[model samples]
Target: MRLLWPSLAVVLLLYPALAEEHNYQLAGPAPGSIRFKWIHGSICAATNRDPRVQAVMYNEDTYILRENIAIHYDAPFTYLLMGNKGALLVDTGATEEAEYYPLRATVDAILKRWGDLRGKTDLPLTVVLTSPEYLSENQGYRQFVNRPNTTLVPLDLAKMKAFYGLTDSWPNGTGRIDLGGRIITVIPTPGAHKDGVTFYDSYNGFLLTGHLLFPGRVMISNDADYVASLTRLKEFSAQHPVKWVLGSQIDMKFLPGVEYMRLIRYKPDEHLLQLEPTALQEALATATRMLGKPEVAILADFTMRNRVGPDERPGRRPANLPRIPQLPNLR
Candidate 1:
């Protein structure tokens, strides 16, 4: 009977992993079924008195933590993905004031809860930003730079390509990381956003795309590069099942053909956070049709605002453009 108990325990442990793999074929939760589990209330109804960082349990292992718009106008959304071996925190949001924002503390609280639920202690945290510019734009990098049991993954093209084993080909260049049983594919997409990259969680069928393909103003820094990225994204999506395309910021207003003002803190009636694959294809088609044209193009769900000047061409930035601000020396 001693061997029987051990065998039974092994089966019990492997069952979840096996079942998760089987369910991946189905992609993710059913349509209209993948709603965010808000801690307080819906986005429109949530009171301003709620916590600055509201944690919404996206799924059993994935948590979508949104920064309060009142705290920062951008109010970017960060993701906490838990795995058997460790946990991954994607994006820090636009809050430099750690005392007021407390992103690390909020992450720690979620990690603690995750650890307790899994009967594990001190699951290492791997912090990764979608873009380096977020270090300046978001200003939340300082809060996590010196945290305990945390490793910040650099968002460098060469380094990330090597780390993820992405190739120069269409889908082969995509990097893959095994977060325990869950596998995340990292696609290097730089154009719409600087050093832009997208993370695809195969387990949950989530494509955590940052500013690259958000619903709001998708400022295209380079037309050619952005088109190539979109083509690659469309091809990648064809091969894999994408349940949700989650982005950092949302600028679409509740009313159709309307948008929120820039740097506006409060978003009373905003659009939904999640987007579908068709939206990506539409963006791709729009970019393909306006390949040589260096003018801004507005689509149904998003606007492709081109920032390229007369002297600059696609895939290259203007020489005189101001550089992104650097983080203060945390050491």
Candidate 2:
């Protein structure tokens, strides 16, 4: 696998923002048409030119929005929705005006495509943000404010209260959203990203995973709760059998410096979908590797890199740790 030197170097320096926050914008074109740029690399290239953005249309109706937004680091904002009921949007693109150009237009195009639902007069539409990144950074959401009954659903209730305006509820775990007649089930998976989550469309076994399960990447996880959240999906899939593995971002070649601009869809049953089981096993193993190993230093290093102004990343440590003696055993 090719490694992103800048990303890895930033990681080595332990910059929290490099992993958590993205700083980039759209490069070319207008709404309905867009190309993203790697702001970091653009400045470093000898040509001092923007990196060519690759756009991959996952399908006619299903779009990986990140395909249109600048990729700052490893992950990109991804959205997935089928009609209104089974709408499973992954990540909200960036939080800036430049990045919002295509993101807002793409969302409008999606809503317009699903205009058949006659009940739009009432029961307004709810755009669910699987995690905070989808909502916090993406200022484009402001465009949806005019829509009737438009509400933003987040994962953390306290954060929802602090930032989001429309809806004040944070998804605790598994919850159901009645999108008119459409159904969206939110499954909280908090490991890879803080308060990160995924949504399963009960209507069609379509699993819209954000940064949780990016194709060809070792789900960079550390926090135990997030790992536990991912484990829950393994158990759920064992019972429910996810038919489709729809990801936000994917690079088929796994080559370095080759950015992916498309969503990779895998039809398990159709293609003998056994890869998920293997992938799930690997994800868990990675999480287990962190167990008993103190991650405070990693967290501290990440914070130092971000130049976190004042507020520190907040969350309680998992209670289940092996108790070690205060001093060496006297034998």
Put down candidate 1 lDDT per residue, 170-275, tens digits, no spaces: 3337776666766778887877665677898877777888888776777777778888888888899998888778888877664443457676666666767788
RMSD of 2: 19.1
- Per-residue lDDT of model 2, residues 206-253, tens digit only: 566665654533234445665677678778777764655554444322
Task: Give the whole-model CA lDDT for all candidates, comma-separated.
Answer: 0.71, 0.45
Give candidate 2's error at residue 249 in angstroms.
3.4
Query: After best superposition, candidate 1 residue 144: deviation in angstroms?
Result: 1.7
Model 1, position 2: C-alpha lDDT score: 83
RMSD of each: 11.5, 19.1
Worst 10 residues of 2 by lDDT: 297-306
Q: How close is candidate 2 to the true structure, as a TM-score?
A: 0.54
